[model samples]
Target: MASAALGEELKCSICLYFYADPVTMRCCGHNFCRVCIDHVLNTQDLESRVYSCPGCSIKFQERPALQKNVTLGNMVEKFLSTHRDGAVISCTYCVDSPVPAVRSCLLCEASLCDKHLRVHSKSPEHVLNDPSTSLEKRKCSVHKEFLKYYCTKDAICICMSCRLDGKHRGHRVEILAKASENKKKKLRNVLEKLVTKREKTEVRVRSVEERRRKSQEKASGEAERVTALFIDIRRRLDDLEKRILREISRQEEKLSLSSSDVIQRLEIKKEELSRKMRHIEELCNMADPLTVLQDPDTGDLCDPEVERGDEDIEENGVGDQDLGQISRISHSLADIIRGVALYVQDPADTLLDVNTAGNNLLISDDLKTATWTETCQNHRQTAKRFLNYHQVMSRRGYISGRHYWDVEMSKLGVCRVGMCYPSIDREGDKSVIGDNTKSWCLFGGQGYDNQCSVKHNNNQIRLPHQISSNRVRICLDYEAGQLSFYELCDPIRHLHTFTATFTEPLHAALWVCGGSIKILGRSSYEEP
Candidate 1:
C-alpha cells in the first residue's frame, strides 16, 4: 500500500495520472509528463519559446532541455496496451459501439470512422497517427492541407499547385526532408557549445567557493589572536589595581606612626615647663624678701633659698623655648602629611600629561595656513600635484583616498590598480596606530644620497633594515586575499598587463587602509 501511494505521488499534476516521459522546467523547478505539457500548450495561444508553469505560474526565460522519463512512460504505455482488448472507445462520426482502435488525421481536423479512416490511410498526402503525434502535426501551419509534393524552390511542403505558381519562379529550394537534415546538423553544433559553457560555469563557481572558504578561515584566526591580546591586557589591569592599593596602605601607615611621635614630644615638654613655672612664682611671693635673697659672701642660710628660686626661673625659660620649637616642627610635619594624603586621594594627581609633544599626536597643523611660497619650497613638484587628495577612514583603519597621477608605462587600456611611491622621512613612524609595526621601517640606504632616494620612493621598495630600492611594487590581488609587496626589476620595467590565480578571496575595505603603495584604480577577476 505504501509503495502504491509513493508511485501516485510522483505522477504529473497536469495529466492527473502517472508520469509519461517527464520534463523538468528549470525556472519553476517543476516536473510534468512531456505529453501532458505539450497538450496543455497546444490548447493555448503559443508565442514564446520560453514558458511559465501552469501549476505555479512561474515564468522560465531559459527553456529547460526536454528529458524522457522512460520508466514511467513505458509503464503507462504497457498498462494501456495490455488492457486494449477490454477498453471501449466508440467512433465519433458513426456513434458506433466499441471500435477496436482509435486514430487521428493530421491533414483533416477530425476523428475518423473505420470506413473513412481507410481513405486517410490510402491517401499518400494524408498523415495519420496516434493522438500525441496528430496534435503536434496540427500545430504545423504549413502542413495543414494535404501536401504530397515539396516546393523545391522554397524548401516547403506544398501542394503540386504551389510549385506551378509564378510566385516561386527562378528560386532555388529543396525538399523539407533535406532541409530538416541540415537543421539537425546545426542543432548538434549548438549543443556541443552549450555543454562546454556549462562545464566552464561549474568550474568558475567551484573556484569562488574555495576562495571564500579560505578567506573565512583567515579572518577567524585573526579574530582569535586579537581576543587573546585583550585577555592579557585585562589581566595586567587587575594586577595594576592591586599594586596601587598596597602602596597607598604603606603610605598611610608611615603617616600614622609619625603623628604619634610628634604628639608625645609636645605633651612631655608642656608638663616639664609647667612644673618649673610654679616653683618660680612660689619663691617670688615669699614673706621674708631679704631672707629669700641670695648673698655672695660665704655660703649661708640667708641666701640659699633665693639662689634655688633663681635657678628654677632660668630652667622654666629654657623649657618654654624648647616647647615653642617643638610646636612649630610638629605643625610643619602635619602640613606635609596632609599634602601627601591629598595627592594620593585624587585621581587627577596620578595622571601624567596626555597632550605633551612626545605623546601620540591627535592634531595636525593646518597645512592650508602655510604660505604659497613655503608650500612650493617644502613640497616636491609631483607631491604638490596631489595636494587635493584626502584619506579614507573606516572602523578598521585609515586608507589612502583617491588621486590622479601617472607612472611611466607603455600600455593604453582601462586602468586596473595603481601603486604609489611617496617621499617619507625616516623619523616619521605611525604604525603603532594599528599595531602594524612592519609599515614604519623605510627602505634604508647609506648617507645623504641613499636617504634622498628612499624618501622619493615607497618604503616597500626594500625590506625592514634594507639598504636599497632596487625594485618594488605593491599590488592589490583580490583573489589572493592579500595586498602583496613585490620587488620589481631595476631600469624601470615595462609591460603592465598581468593576471594571476589566488588561493583565497579578499576582504572588502582593505584598500581603505593606506599602504606603502597606493592603488590607483579598480580590480576584478576573470571567471576560473
Candidate 2:
C-alpha cells in the first residue's frame, strides 16, 4: 500500500505516468514532467502572455521558470526498478483467502500455492515456470501448445507440432534457451563498440570545454585593460580642457586692464582738447589778429602723433601671442594620446618551421632562432623549402583578428623581419621575404650605412633615419588590412605601416644573411 501511494505521487498529472524528468512549478510548487508542462505552456494563448499550471490551475502573469525536482525523479526511478512486474500473482484455488503462488502451470493456466504444488500434474506438456500473471503469452495461439523451440528462418517461437507439421516443418530451428543466449552474445559485442565510441566522444567534449574556458578568461582580461586605458585618456582630456580654458581667462583679464588704461588716457586728452577749444573761441573773439596769433598753437596742444599712438594701442589690444599659447596647449592633447602604446591582448605564439627553412639557414632546436651559415646543411628538398634565399617561415599562420610578436636581432646585419603568404615562390628570387606581391618586410642593411627600408612587391620606401634599436615589434590587424612595424626603444616609435587587402593567411617570415635573429615570444603592452 505504501509503494502504491508513492507511485501515485510520482506520476505526472498531464501524462498519467511516472515522471521522466520531473519539474516543479514556481507559482504553485506542484511537480510535473518537463515535456508535459512545456507542451501545455507552448499551446497557450501567446497574446495573453500568461500560462496556467496543469496540476493546480494556477494562473501566471508570465511563463515561469521550471525548477527540476531531482529527489522526486530519483524516487520514481527506484520504484520502477523495485516493482517492475506490477502486483504479485496469487493461487487460483485459494478463493476463500488469496495466497502468493510459487509456480504457474502453462497447460492448466493457473498459479499454484505451495500446498497445491505437491499434487499438481508433472507431465511434459504442463510446463511449470516462475510465478507469472501472463500465462497466455507463454502458449502458441494456433496450436494451443507451449512454445518449445525458435524457428531461425521465421525468427519466431513455435510449439512442437508447428516445428514438425506446420509451416515451419522444413526450416532450421533451435531450442528457445540456446537461441536467446546467442542473440545476447551478439548484442554484447555491439554494446562494447558503442562504449568505446562514447569514451572517445567524452574526451573531445572535455577538450572543447577547456578551450571555451580559456577564451572567456582572455576576453575578461582584455576588457579590464581596455577600460582602464580609456579611463586614463578621459581624465587627461578633462585636464587639458580645464587648462586651455584657464589660459583663455588669463589673456582676457590682461587685455581688459590694458584697455582700461587706454580709456583713462583718452578721457584726460578729451578734457584738455575741450578746454583748448574754449580758449581758441576766446582768442577768436578778440578784435585784433595779433591776439589770436599770440595764443599758443592749438594744433600743437592736441598732438596728432600722440592721439594716433593711443588709437593703435586700442586697435591692437588682442595679440596673436595669446592665441599661439592656447594653440600650443591644444596640440599637446594629441601628443598625450600618441604617447600611449598599442594595447594587444592576443599575441601569436610563433615558431620557425624546419620544413620550410632554406639549406643555408640554420634553425635553433627550440625553433625560435634562425641563423645564416656559409655551409649548406643536408636538408631534404621539399616543395615548401626555400632553395635560393636564406629564409624560413613560421609553423603557424593567421587569417583574422589582431596579433603581435617581437623579434630581437643579435647582430643587425642584413636581417629582414616580415610576413608572407604560404604560397610564396620557393625556388626563385621571389621566394625572398618582401620580393613579391605575396610578402611585406622591413629590411635592415649591414655596415656603416645602417640604412632601413620597407619593401613590398619590389617597391621599397627608404626611411629617413637609421633604426638604432635591435628589437622590433610586428603588429597585424587582418580585418582592417593593416600591418605595422615599430622600433622598441625608450619610447616605442612607429617605423612604417603597410595597408592591403590580404588574400590568404599570413605566416611570419625571416631572412638572415650575415647575422642571426631570434623570436622574443609574443609582445604585450604594459601600462606605463
TM-score of each prediction: 0.38, 0.60
Candidate 1 clash pair list: 152-173, 153-173, 399-512, 399-514, 418-520
lDDT of each: 0.40, 0.82
Q: Which ten residues in a row have the lowest lDDT in candidate 2?
A: 338-347
- Candidate 2 lDDT over residue span 11-45, tens digit each: 89999999987999877899889878877875663
Per-residue lDDT tens digits for candidate 1, residues 1-528, read 443455566678987776766776655557788768765553342344456678797666554455555665665664443233433333446654534335666555555656767766557446665532234444334423444444555665664344455355455555556766777898989978986896687567557766766677767775675477446444644554565555555555665665566556556656865765675576667787775565233244246775676555444433212344344434433332221111111111111111211111111232101111112222233321222211111111113221111111112211112222122111233311111222211221222233211211222232233324433333343343234332233222221222333232221111111111222222222221
Question: Candidate 1: misplaced stretches above 4 Å?
Answer: 1-103, 107-120, 133-144, 147-172, 270-528
Best by lDDT: 2
User: Candidate 1 at 316: error in angstroms?
Assistant: 27
User: For all the candidates, what are their Cα RMSDs to the real structure?
Assistant: 20.9, 11.3
